[model samples]
Target: MSSTATHTDDDLMTVPDVLHVLRPLSKRTFYRWRETGKAPICIRLPNGELRIHRSDFKEWLDSHREQVAA
Candidate 1:
């Protein structure tokens, strides 16, 4: 990934931004995960838009990692 694609912990990701990285995943599925509390934590902006912090997104992804036996 290029520096431009890297996000800091404090960086806020919009739905489209996340979708870009999570391609092949539909917006409906993402929203469904959010509704079920399975997606990364997100904050609703004053305009009702959702944003997820980079750190939280990383944590969420990490939590779903599968362990393999050596």
Candidate 2:
């Protein structure tokens, strides 16, 4: 017998996963934003892992979109 598994959107990412997706931004830039208090707020799990919500990240990107009418 063969088995298959399905993955949900939430299952698609973790902090490092998100970082990998945003490759144009260096790791240093991510840390720098944290230090400067300019990064989108992250959530800290009970185990102390930091995570940025996918929705929040999308909102941040939308807000920074170019104003050009094209």
Candidate 3:
């Protein structure tokens, strides 16, 4: 799929899926954020997969918004 491609509505994104659309980062750093409560909320499936709602990820990003100096 293209970089701009997005999941269909009502889709639950896997950890790697979410990372694909966002900035690339090491899995170590990503999990560190989760442990420190800095990353967007994630849920673990009964089968041990991590998932996040696209909408919730957007909300989390919005809440952490900051201005950058040009």
Which portions of model 2 show Cα errors greater than 4 Å?
1-13
Over 4 Å off, model 3: 1-9, 67-70
Predicted candidate 1 versus true structure: per-residue lDDT over 1-70, tens digit per residue: 5666755899999999888888988999999998898888999999999999989988988999999989
Local distance difference test, candidate 2? 0.70
Give the per-residue lDDT digits (tens) of candidate 3, residues 1-70.
Answer: 6789666545677888767866577778888899999888888999988988888888887898898999
Clashing pairs in 3: none
Any runs in candidate 1 off by more than 4 Å, and if so which?
1-6
- In model 1, the clashing pairs are none
Best by TM-score: 1
| Whole-model lDDT per candidate | 0.90, 0.70, 0.80
Give a tens-digit lDDT track for model 2, residues 1-70.
5588654534424667667778777778887887898766677789977777667776666777899887
Clashes of each: 0, 0, 0
Residue 53 CA error for candidate 3 (Å)? 0.6
